[model samples]
Target chain A: MRISQLSAASGVPIPTIKYYLREGLLQPGEQTAATRAEYGEAHLRRLRLIRALLEVGRVPVTAIRQIIAAVEDETMPVHEMLGTAHYALATPVEAAADDDRHREALALVDALIGELGWQVTPEAPTRAELAQVLVRLDRLGRPASVEKLRPYAEHVARFAREREMDSVSGPREAAVESLVVGTVLYGKVLDVLRRIAHESESARRHTSGHPAAPAG
Target chain B: MRISQLSAASGVPIPTIKYYLREGLLQPGEQTAATRAEYGEAHLRRLRLIRALLEVGRVPVTAIRQIIAAVEDETMPVHEMLGTAHYALATPVEAAADDDRHREALALVDALIGELGWQVTPEAPTRAELAQVLVRLDRLGRPASVEKLRPYAEHVARFAREREMDSVSGPREAAVESLVVGTVLYGKVLDVLRRIAHESESARRHTSGHPAAPAG
Candidate 1:
């Protein structure tokens, strides 16, 4: 297929496709002419996968390149692909860029896993993602202590599991959507709810005549 | 109070204080001399708030600066601050970065609150955090619709709440910890759990007496 045909099949705009090609994210197709190129089913498949990683996984191109390289490498195992995807999905991008704090964050992540006795997978929260937080801390000169994060991790892990239980209804499309929205949006929602929850608690206390004196 | 004194009181280092001063994240203390900068209780207080925004809120310095400025401005309405923080916490950083998408994400979040008939503040994932996925997708384009994300959000959110209900005997410290953990780490954890869930489902289907093709 030609470039336009690939564009039609993949639903990526021609300009975007050209951009990907320029970035070396997508491999060049068969050289049909000095000015034109031909693509194949492989390109189509690659494009779809790319879209999934970007749109759903929200992975960055640099990592995507590495992941695809791993996928294309015959020496690499299928488990490796799954592992990479898992890592790509879970790991943060910052961890990869900053080597100094990456190990520490990983240690924290591991410690949390151990401390909580969580049945978590190998690729939970991409290293880059976690590292990004650490890097920010380093930049802020307030790098979080691993010990400080342990409890945080444990609490979140428990809820992570709980949320999974709530949303995993036969792996339907809607099920995946719930998972994304909950994890992506739940914290803010809870924060809002907690505010109201606090208000309600206060109202109850006031109405019940347990009116605590305001802080002096 | 000197830099060291403020550092000791706030548990922030002198270097970090300097950085905050240089970044204008924290106001400069009274300048005693070329070498000596006298700090005060206000500096300590500012440092604490900065830490809260950076660590707990995971807000960027730029945003933090704006927020702090707004707070200091006084003319800035409380609702605006609430809206900023509300959106900061609830919406994905990248989505919120784009004025249009940010509004849409916020609208959807509001819709969720209304639809669920719950009083909850929706938090957005950080753009730096979400950027990992976007970068990945740029390389590995896949065809995904916004429709698929709904269940993903719901499941994670429900599980988060359920976990909070389970873990917190007192919804104070433990609740706060759970909130952070669930928000930051649950997605990664769920990425792993989903795999296990998929495998378990596969096994169950295969082992059952009823013969059916594998669904994935």
Candidate 2:
């Protein structure tokens, strides 16, 4: 098959496929001409795997590249593929807001450092990232409820510690990779939990007699 | 205090403060000079709140702006603010990769669409996002015990469905907002549950025997 066919089949655009190749993420295919290349079942399978990592796993390109290399080696195992994807998705989204929000974001970062006792850097999901949540909290007129968020925070913290302990048993190389991957995946884990809590709360509210109508 | 003092005290830089004002994400301090302005505790607190939303909540600037407007209006309710933030972080990440690996992402998205019957958009989560998880999965060399993940997924679906049933009695506007927010927070809810599951897995593994070391 041709690159266009691959793109059509994979639901990825041609330009993006070119980018992946330029970035050294995807391997070079059999050259049909100076400008063209031929792909096949492996390419199709790999495309599907790549899509899974991006959609369900939320893996970044750099991480995806590494995994792709491993997958192509044939020496790599299936479990490794799944584990790598899991960790990649777990990474917290980096704060990349425009300059306008930087000050408010920095202040939030400082507050987390000074007040919340978190040892995060400005680059890690900085204040700009959390500002959205604070604004939402403010809008809801429940800025005070951050106190309520504590228990849930603690619940996550405990589990995070547990995951840390579990991660330490690996070989040094694997452990480091796992830690990096774990850090990434932790963000997604938070995402998943937050959703569940909302759903559970809504469920409880309904069972209490105030069956809320679905929003338009 | 002068902008510098505010910066010093708030740990936010002076230029960033100016940027916030320029963007209208933050209100201007007392207008002392045509160019120089004095800020106060309110500014500091508001800045902090903005930072919190950006860093901890991982909300977008546009959303933060809307949220701020709601909070300042005094018309917005507390629960609404809380709910919105929860949802913002809960929505799925966008897809942004173009490789064979993305096929996996497309498959899962298709599965969710076909088998699970969700109304999510194809652009909902990009392949780049899902690839993160795939990389980790690849590294871990474990099957994600999809069997392990299945129960949690089911639990979340049930939780969500139950909530949809319950909120039917609320005022139309509130119910509508709740559903929207519910969809957004869906990701967070899963995060929380997965963390819980990880802990449960950890506890089980720890109690079972020698810790399960990572594969070499």
Measured by TM-score, the strongest candidate is 1
The list of candidate 2 runs beyond 4 A from truth reads A1-193, A199-209, A212-216, B31-38, B55-60, B84-150, B153-216
User: How high is the lDDT of residue B211 in model 1?
Assistant: 42
Model 1 Cα shift for residue B137 (angstroms): 11
DockQ of 2: 0.07
Candidate 2 displacement at residue A51 in angstroms: 8.3
Over 4 Å off in model 1, which ranges? A1-3, A13-43, A54-78, A88-108, A115-216, B1-4, B11-43, B54-110, B120-216
Docking class of 1: incorrect
lDDT of 1 by residue, B1-216 (tens): 887888888888879888998998888888889988888766765776677667766878887777667556656544343334434444344433455444444454445434544333333333233333333322333222234334444444454454433432231222333333333333334343344333223233224454433321
Q: Give the C-alpha miss distance for residue A184 in model 1, angstroms.
A: 9.4
For model 1, how does the per-residue alpha-carbon lDDT over A1-216 read when each residue is reduced to its tens digit? Answer: 988888887779999999989988788998989988889877876676676567666779997787777766767543344445545555335326566567776675555444544444454454335555555555444456656555445444454454434443332222333333333333333343443333223233224444432422
Candidate 1, residue B143: the lDDT equals 20
TM-score of chain A of 1: 0.48
lDDT of 2 by residue, A163-195 (tens): 444653443234334433454454543345334
